[model samples]
Target chain A: MEKKVILDGNAVAASVKESLKERINLLAQEGITPCLATILVGDDPSSETYVRMKGNACEKLGIISKRIHLPKETTTEELLETITELNEDEKVHGILLQHPVPEQIDERKAFETIAIEKDVDGVTSLGYGQTAFGFGVYPSCTPAAILEIMDFYNIDASGKHAVVVGRSPILGKPVSALLLNRNATVTTCHSYTSNLEQFVKQADIVVAAVGKPNFIQGEWIKEGAVVLDAGYNKGNIGDADYESCAEKASAITPVPGGVGPVTISMLLKHTVISAESYMSKKSATL
Target chain B: MEKKVILDGNAVAASVKESLKERINLLAQEGITPCLATILVGDDPSSETYVRMKGNACEKLGIISKRIHLPKETTTEELLETITELNEDEKVHGILLQHPVPEQIDERKAFETIAIEKDVDGVTSLGYGQTAFGFGVYPSCTPAAILEIMDFYNIDASGKHAVVVGRSPILGKPVSALLLNRNATVTTCHSYTSNLEQFVKQADIVVAAVGKPNFIQGEWIKEGAVVLDAGYNKGNIGDADYESCAEKASAITPVPGGVGPVTISMLLKHTVISAESYMSKKSATL
Candidate 1:
């Protein structure tokens, strides 16, 4: 059988941005500018890089970007107050809090404090629930991006056995729930799971999001199984051993060009959606 | 191996109700009475009977029971408005709209309209997501009832391969999610599933919620698997052919006396929780 073609995540994301320029223009004409508020705490190297990339994307899409820089010693109460202020800011259509706030902060509580309507990053439990139930709302950017790719590629997931090898609240759980909503039988395995290979060997689709580089061996993959590596390691290494698996599998997404770029694209898309919903709410009252 | 004991559903439910009375009295001292709102339309004979049973259960537990009677000709919008009214009513804690609303009404919309905070019955998508995620305010009563029964009977579901044959939003889907949360590998099958027997035969636990009687045959069951039948069919029949499978299975819940009674008990429990929550919210301001 002929090998399936590879897809470049950055190229796909660029196309999505190109498509959104027209919508952004329309919104500007109507006197609405989509605004994204990015909150960064401490000077984590990777987080700074990610924030920079997102800000650049916002500029490219003609959306207004506001950056809130906080020190590493910031208290939970202070951070929450800042988020509350953003919630009340009419100009702010979406709020994005960079991950790994601080060791002293309650991350879950911080995520929950984001207004459900303004949770453009879709990190709140309510937002994740809405997405998992297919109620047509913003989903967490990365998982939503993966779904977009699957839909764009016309992959049929219904009735397929999907093994998700991570159980993180934000990524693994939500994505697994999403796959289940699409009629795929989903199994979520974590560090606590025994016999990991047994589960991977049975999946028609394998989604590795454990953050460990090359955690999934090529030998465990079922022939022709659709592989999605939602991991980014040092030097662009992925959760899956891509080189060996690419030769054996029918289709696989590369490390840097796979899920990374799509995440920001989905984030930009949500900014527009947030702007639209905010506009509709405002217009309805008028 | 010794034959497993079967408990009567009505007897189990009565025991649960009796145990909950002490808590009800304690809450009443604080001017709070666990309350349940039962909504019935068109006087469907079976639905009316079920509603009456649930209300009676509330009365027996020292809980308040409120009934909303609507005409058969009620439109989806009208029903939604009524539910919205109940959702906003302080005295109404939990709302139960009997399933299979008049054919003219959109059932899912009516169910989804119930506020998650007031959804003690746990039928809303929010409730389902919470139950699936194992962190929600309420779990769907039928699934909770099943888990309660298993707990009471000392049946361990951890690491079990649970094959749930049904994919309805309320029952099969939520129950499978609950099972997965409990560390079981759960596979949910529906009407469209092919080779259903293959999955059913491999399960350590089989939950048959498909309404068709005798849908799961005896030979398909493993020699010592536990069985939970949540089906309520006409003429008191269950999804499983009890006589044939009862002999082979290590433990089995009889149709009339198994999952049926426990569901009503769970519904009553949810009402109490809702009432407690309502009282606490009020107390917080005072």
Candidate 2:
């Protein structure tokens, strides 16, 4: 077989950000800055790193990043109050609540408190619904990123058999919804799925979002299948056995630079979009 | 081969209605009658019959049925206004806008106008999201009916490979979400799906919602698989060629009395549930 194509996330991310620079400059002319407020309620090192990286990305793109680090013991009510404040704040174009808050916090309730307009991370139930219905302004970023990579690489999803492993609400479920909306015949598989390999072997496209390292093996991949791995495990490994699967896949995204970079870029893009929406509404009213 | 089991809809629907009677009486004691307000736009004979059937079902259960009939030329704005009125009405426990409004009406916008509290038919984008997340109050009736039948028959969805043929917002999509929530590995296929038979043959549970009579052929069925046909086509035929499929299937729902009766029962059940919710809130406030 000929050399397999590596789906480059950095290239996709760079292109995405490059396209946004012009839009960001337009907002700058209107004296408005695209702002994203990210709330981190715990001190998990990984979550902290993710937040900082997002914040840095925002700064790089001429957007404002407002980081709110709440103590681990914060109550759900307090979290709701903070979200309400951001919802009312005219300058905050986007709001993101980092996942895995303290055990006591009602996480879903807190996510619900974020106004739909500012839910840039797409954690809200309403946001998820809108995305599933196909008119959502901002889908959950990771799912959006998966599509961005596909679109960048010119991978057509329409009329294809795409098997998605894992069904996490943000990553797996939303991405499945996105692919389905694009007219792919989507099979959503999880740990409870029986005979998983049988389904994977028949796919035109395989999406690995199961989170476990090397969960999807080489033999599971069909010849010339397009593989998009959305997993980021310890030691930077993805859900699929990369070296082996790449041998069979016609196109595959590597772990470190595959989906993660594009995900942050999507968040930034959503913030800019939200800011533009606000500016347009402001202009209309003026 | 031993005879296949016929999944009887009348038996399941009767049981559901029988269970609701006591709850309905409790609401009556509280001086609250469960009410469903249905908005029917235009004079499509099929839609008219459906609305009337739902109204009749509500009356049979001692629930109030408020039917609003509008002309073919009704604009989206007029439909939205009617929905808003129902949303604000304290006595209306549920609101259902019959599908396939006239060409000029913005059907989705009108569906969105019904308040979340009154979206018993599960038409709104918000409701679809809630259903996907597994916390929806009322799922679209047909999807709910499909699950009700599965539960009624004690067929477990967990770990099963379910193939859903159709992607309609109200039927195929919601049912796929519902089955996924129940831990079934779900493949959502539509007309765009390639080699539809191969997917169907792999299913442990097959849901036919494609709206075309005999679309799912008998040869596509796996031996001993459970089939739930949600299609109601002309001449009282189902999506599945029932006679042929039944021979190869372990259990299947018949068209005329199958999913159809249970669907209306689910609507009635949802209206009563909404009324019960209303009563509890009123009591708590008191």
Docking quality of model 1: it rates as: acceptable
lDDT of each: 0.84, 0.94
Instruction: Give TM per candidate.
Output: 0.92, 0.99
Per-residue lDDT of model 1, residues A10-79, tens digit only: 7778878888888888888879999999999999999999898999889877899899999999989999
Write candidate 2's Cα lDDT for A157-258 as tens digits: 999999999998898889999999999999999989989999999899999999899899999999999999999999999999999999999999999999
Model 1 CA lDDT for position B131: 66
Indicate the DockQ of the complex predicted as candidate 1.
0.36
Distance from true position, residue B86, model 2, in Å?
0.9
Clashes of each: 0, 0
